[model samples]
Target: MDFSSKLYSIESELTQEDLDSLKFLCLDLLPNKKLLSIKSNLDLFKELEKHSLLEEDKYDLLAELLYIIGQHSLLRILGTNKWAMQETLKKNRTVSLYRQMLFQLYEDLTSEDLKSILFLLNIPKKYEENKKFLDILYYLEKNEQLSEDKLDVLEKAVSMVSQELLRKINDYKKTRVKENTSTQSLYDDKMKLSIEVVEQVSSQDRGMKSTVELVQHVSEAANGKDLMDKNTESCMSDLSLNEQSETEVYAMNRKHRGYCLIINNSEFMKSDPRLGTEKDADFLTNVFTWLGLDVQIRNELSTQQICDCLIDFKQRDQTERDCFVCCILTHGKSQAVYGTDNAFVHINKITSYFSTKNCPTLAGKPKLFFIQACQGKTHQGAHAIESDAVSSVEERKTKITIPDDADILVGMSTVDGYYSFRDIRKGSWYIQALCENLTKMVPKGEDILSILTKVNKDVSEMEYSKDRKTSMKQMPQPAYTLRLKLVFPIPLAPFKPLFQETN
Candidate 1:
């Protein structure tokens, strides 16, 4: 009944290949360096236990991993069967989109077909030694000829090998296109709402001063109450009285854009030290500072310190500043992340600290939380989705009301119950993509949500496919309640800092 005993019982039922598959399924969940040394099921469980992912009462992750690798016979050791797992994961599968794609390709491709495709690819003859189709795909990824976004090289080679495989690739591309279109449509809806609000006001009052007056009137009339608080005032006042931009944006012209808090937890008391987080911290501090925000970095904090830090910010009077930003880089699990002491700090608790009731000053201002942590331990594998009839788009009437939780954005490194990846050498996939997108996209006037959409696409395309079995993938998730467009206009010149940088 104990956790180690359960793992030992499972180990007896598994062969070397089964163990390898289990480890492969865990590639996205566990550290690669630790996984390499897991020659037995017990060893793998030990690593999971170290991360607080497995316990005597909590063996669901282990069971899911076994089920994912098709070691179904071993599932009963954890008191679950394949049929039950099938139903449980029907709506929420753990295998990543990238992994499922490669697995499906391997299952359909013949050995001869692989050889022919490899020949067409003109891959080095040395790779000809690789017999598995997945191995060949790994080579393509390693050589930078294939990725989630780029499949031209594989598509061309596969076309000559088999039309079915080519169709599969095309289906995957269609799904990606549809997803992108859906995201763009959401952006368009927000923009439309902005335009509708403006047009409604413009129909009656055309001047810049009238625009502000109309916003307050329309909002009050639509909501049937006075909701124009200090935050709403800040949102509207960001626009110049004499000259308004073509599009409305949240105020970012203040000399100080409030605090950009970077909580970088690299060292842990129990868990593996997070390597390469220094790069994320450094990059965020520099970029946010350049964007006219006061950057503060806090390295290696316990759970108490994290709570204390949030309380400190929540209590601060941010009336003079324009917005707030917080970045958390650490190990995590479902709905919560770990501190240096390996304790849980629920994300709800963190976000609640900045609620309008909790922190009145930040009520209307944007409070951005960029969390570089995994939401869960599930691995996302790619799969083909059959095309369905497109539904007709509908437009709805717009109403503006500032809820208690408005102006908040939480950018998660991965979706719920999945892993987010990091390189020991180059920092995390989410942070790297996020910083890169912000640096590249902000100057072009894209709002934060749009920039985050680009970040989602960039991180999803990345894979740590060292080999076919250990191919890993990640997807970033963004959730926001922002009422107005949040854009950080590039300052004419980087503001000289007056505060000392803290490590």
Candidate 2:
């Protein structure tokens, strides 16, 4: 039963005392002897928490209030929530004004029998998130205060929303696919034209003619530059190796490809040499190259060299690129990797280089770090951690600390304080699994993080037992401070751009 109907059915059994109690409750909720605020209804429930009434009594009172409010022409049903009968107050709008507008909208909506509700619920579905709309559905499902039938209606409504959302998404994808096909055709024509221009000029080079000059003079180009040897390809780079879904081929703002920095530290003098590191680099080079990255492979780097290499990359212009990725194949300790000089460079230092404040060109772009190194010594332990001892009390005040707002992801070969599993023949388990899954999942339209999760699951589940009692287990860990969903070989329409909203 609806809240109103249920209250009407039970009102016959209630005495004057019960009705009086509800009237007193409602009166107490009024601000300064009047319904002075829009939060009066919300405050009524909040204040009811202090009462010791039975659950049924509380329900009865709530239903009675709802019924009375509806009957008294108080249809301005709205709260701070998005799907509330009223509109949510904006940050700049006062509650009273917001409430008035919400009621006006509600009045307009009710005249058409819930037309607004259906329209609001049908939020546009994309690969990116729609937080407000999705949250409203979540709120409806989790609200236990509503009756069963009402909840059922909400569930069905949400189901229809999902169905409609899916159809719209599929249609959108079809349209994009069509658009992308046209783009591809245009790119191919440009490439063919450039090739013809280049080959034609080269054929007549015996005369006083330079093909470079001829191509530049004849072919129309952007920025007065010749479009020769045009690579008619799309790159997924760090986010994807082959997934076309993640590719943003036509983005004039984003780069055609990102840069991949490979640091292979194998010549460890103070420690055991990390063999098979080259295999990892070679394989990744091919993978990332196929994925459309400008692959840079460096060998035998010291701590300072590693730092300097990153600094150099950071200094270079990357505004034309979508992201930056670094892969280090080396031995390591907890939170640090060993350079060829056997010096330790903390991982955070490397990541800090790409922060929005430091790397302005890559401000809003993704920065991926794939480290194949040991964290520290570890063993399986599951127990309650003892609390820290109390210290001398001092004056304290609340302080709002904001987190770093940059898109950076670090993928580790093993959990902290654990050994990474590897083979002298096949290279490290994590890197191998990452490469394999990237190849497999990219075509299937899986995003970078999902692909990484699969890599982690597969690596952790692998059995490398020397005997029945002895085995090796390696769990990869990916830590990220990403502000947006990242896909490779393609880009999705961002609901809103982060880090690029200029002053």
- Please, what are the lDDT tens digits per residue for candidate 2 over residues 1-503? 55444434445334443343333334333342332232333333444544532143245335334332222111112111111211111111112221222222222222222433445445344411433322333344345422222333443443444443333333333444554565576677666666776666667754676656675644664222233222212211111111122223223245457899999877676766666566678778877776778899989998999999999999889988978889999877667777877777778888888888878988878889999987764232112111001111321222211227568899988877667755554567888789877765554334688789889878877756555787667789998877655656422221221212112
Q: lDDT for each of the candidates?
A: 0.70, 0.55
Candidate 2 residue runs with Cα over 4 Å from true position: 1-253, 378-403, 490-503
Model 1, residue 284: displacement in angstroms?
A: 0.7
TM per candidate: 0.47, 0.44
Pick by lDDT: which candidate is best? 1
lDDT of 2 at 339: 81
Error of 1 at 160 (Å): 12
* Cand. 1 Cα-lDDT: 0.70
TM-score of 2: 0.44
Candidate 2 lDDT for residue 106: 29
